[model samples]
Target: MRKPVLTIFYQFNPWSTTIGGIQTLINIFIKYAPPEFAVRLVGTANDKTQPILKWQSAEFAGKEISFLPLFSLKNDNVRSLIPTTVKYTAALLGQCFESDFMHFHRLEPTLAALNWQGEKTLFIHNDIHTQMQTVRDKKAILWRRFPAAYFAVESLLVPQFSQILSCNTDAVKHYKERYKSVSDRVAYIKNSYDNELFYPLNQEEKEVEKRELAQKLGLPDDTRFVLFAGRLHPQKDPTLLVRAIAALNDPCVHLLIAGDGELAAQVRTEIDTSGLTGRVTMLGAVPIAQLAQLHRICNVFVLSSAYEGLPLVVLEALASGTPVVTTECGETPKLLTSNSGIVCRQRTSECIADALRKVLQHPEDYPIESCVETAQPYAARTVVRDIYSEMLNRWEQRVTFAVKV
Candidate 1:
């Protein structure tokens, strides 16, 4: 039998300068796609003047990854906003017409692009309802200025996909409840870590990286660090992480934030107002290779996100044998069992501070090995296989339904 041809439509591909959850997903997907699966990536071309469609093959763990580019022309203003949805939607519709199956990552465009006639799956990584609510409450510039046409499109097509896979169970349940027609289509596929790239460093390497990072970030030799490595967005709740560290009142406890976003100015204001000039360091954007080193040097990984589907960084941090202190976002309890790490109440500076304190006060007592093992099941191969198996089932169902029709 001929293997199915799968084309992935993601607006935000991994080639972007800074890393985020979407980038991590693509990296893992490339690593895990089998030889029999003729996988092709269809993303908005990164550079202008590039061909609308381009293809290439690269070896990942000795398996070849066939990549294709689908360019979407955009006005910078509209592109930064949501009309890019229209762009990607058209691009995906074209691909769906061409490929045997189409898999998508982002929610907005995916919702708009899903076709019931095609073998389609939407990969959701966060609660869009919650994210939309936050944006409405904040009246963010992006929300206020963008076209409302996309929202209308999302309302109609979000439930039409052949399958909907959220990164965590909470998101899956929420989407299922909200869209009963597609309840059976909604499922959970947890995020995975790249064990090969993110792992505990040996003593010599750890010592050298720690010393170098300290020197580069202007930290003292004795300073123990708690690191946050994602976009500095309002939803990511970086200010809360800063407030937590300030509440600690521990001069030796340094907070390292390693990403940039629209909320950069707000985070800078908070850092200045809190008088955490030297204590809180913002390494605007670091390369992926350097980020792994930063994870190794840090004693604890921290997140205070208002919401998450399932953060890949948490798993990455754990695989690196770094203890964690995370807000009670999606699947926080699932990630933090009895002996893993501290999970705090949501959006509270005091609660975050308390959790950080517990990890900092007695770091040796926390089972770092258990934290590492907890992430073993969600390794890249396991996650990709889960996605592949689910796609196969969905494809077969599509065929059966078509035969009946």
Candidate 2:
């Protein structure tokens, strides 16, 4: 029996970077992809200095996977657009023909390979229509101004894909409604977390780890750490978290931000303006191990994002037995329970403040066991296994139909 080659494509390198949830999810998919299939990862190099088209092999989770790095411009300015698109499209057309199936993580890459005649799948990480409307940054808003153009492209491209996967159920509904022609192909697949690395720690163990971490980070032993671990982008609304913390007005509550992005300076300014300098610590892009430890030690995890698909950070926090206080975005409201965390009624800082205060004030209400239990179904092994099985079944059906024709 010959194994089908599944070429997974994304804009950024997953093995070398911790950029976002998409990269994390792709790694999990590759790790748990069934043995009956051969998987190849195709992505752009993060380093601008790296040459365009190159092939390499990387060992991940004890398995050797083929990698193809394509060239991408540093910025998406007018000057770079033509060359970037031409190079990307040419590279995909030249390299992707041999694969049995193509899996794309972003719209741009899928569009570049629009001519690919083989089976194709597109994974929608966010509600594209909502993100275009909600993004507040000047540069992002400028690009999103031409929403009609994007809609036209999506209409032409989406139905051509054999399958459409969205982590958010709301996003799945949106896609089905918008692309009624391919409604049957649209499906909801939940994002997963590494359960092995992010499980509950006992009270005594948590206390010991907290003490060590506080000592290392120069915080008081009794400080209640509220963690926000995502890119400091307009969509994430990181400054909103700062304002919420300041509004809480609790001197004992401290914030530890574990990621950085374009809005880092703006978030810092917000912290300074709100007089939260001493109370907030910017840990700036900690590794996954450190992130899990932070989740276990932190009293609560917070996300004040304007929008999301199904945030992996929230799931990771729950797996680490940490309660969450997040705004109502993506599938969060459905994923959360009363015992797991609080979902803010509004996106306002005051609403987030009140939610945070409640969770911080009554820690006993959200037990470690309850939080961990809430995240059990999203364990990487279970979710990825099911996803691969589904992919294989779809491929089998396509083959049978082709043979009949």
Candidate 3:
């Protein structure tokens, strides 16, 4: 039998050195794609001059997968937005026509490819409405200016997709409730972590790793580390973690920020203003292996995001047997067990500080076994296999129906 081709579209260089949850999820989909199907990826090229419709291939899980990187003008300013959209959409459509199924990782790219008459899937990484309400980035500028247009995309256009997947269970419920017309298509497919790379380290191993990290970052060997590993963007609210660390005011409690982004400057200013200069270390986007090691050695992992779908960092931390202190967002409240971690009642620095203090003061309360157990279900291979099975089943059913018709 000829294998079905699944083409995934998202804006950004997936092959880049530094990537976030969406890109990670894309890679998982490619890596664990059933042997019965072929996969192709469409993403923006790093080089602006990179030609569109040029085919490339990369090996994943001992199999070759096709890649198509499109080029577009930068949409940093308002003047270039329309042209960038048009160019990207045209380029995407040209490549998408031949694929058996299309999977989109972002709303904008999915919106652009709506004209394509094929089986389409949309993955919701974050709640779009919540993002629009809370985020004030370049993308949000247009969304804010045209609320009705955004609503139309959410209400009318979204249901056009054959399937809708959300990493957050709450988001799946939200989509089902809001878009009753396509409720059946909306499902929860969780984000996963590399369990092989992220697992509990023994006490002696952890101490050794901690000492090495301390030496590299020039921190005291006995320092208690609190880690926040994600983009320093408005949605992430990275400064909130900085403020919480300062508010805790424990001389030995140190924060290690592993990622950098748009609010990097602002976060630095907050750290300086709060007099947390030496206490906070900015590692600036460490690799996954390094991040996992940080997770293993840290006293607690913190996420102060204004909103999230389901953060992979939190799962990675749990898999590394590290307790978490995260604001009540997305699936964190449901995801965290009382014996495993703490979820803040409020999104305030004081609340986060108190939560952190509790976890740090009584690490024994959140057992390493409990934390690792919490992360087991989100293991990469298991979740990706389940997702692939679901996609394949749906595709097979559609094909059977088409033949019957």
Error of 2 at 57 (Å): 2.0
lDDT, residue 388, candidate 2: 78
- How good is model 3 by TM-score? 0.90
Candidate 1 similarity to native, TM-score: 0.84
**10 residues in a row with least lDDT, candidate 1:** 73-82
User: In model 2, what is the error at residue 225, expressed in angstroms?
Assistant: 0.4
Q: Give Cα-based local distance difference scores for all models.
A: 0.73, 0.81, 0.79
For model 3, how big is the CA root-mean-square deviation? Answer: 3.2
Question: Which pairs in model 3 have colliding backbones?
Answer: none
Per-residue lDDT of 323 in model 1: 81
Candidate RMSDs in order:
4.0, 3.1, 3.2
Poorest 10 consecutive residues by lDDT, candidate 3: 72-81
For model 1, residues 1-405, the per-residue Cα lDDT tens digits are: 567788777665445554578767776777777665777776655666546666766454456666656664332211244455556766656444346777777655564444435577788887665555554225332443444653675567776677788878767888888788878988877788877888887546666877777777777877888899988766687888888888888998889888887677888899999999989888876777777777877888899887777888888888887888888777756777656688886568888888888887887666557777877888887777877886677667766897899
Best by TM-score: 2
Residue 229 in candidate 2 has what lDDT?
93
How does residue 89 of candidate 1 score in lDDT? 60
User: Which one is best on lDDT?
Assistant: 2
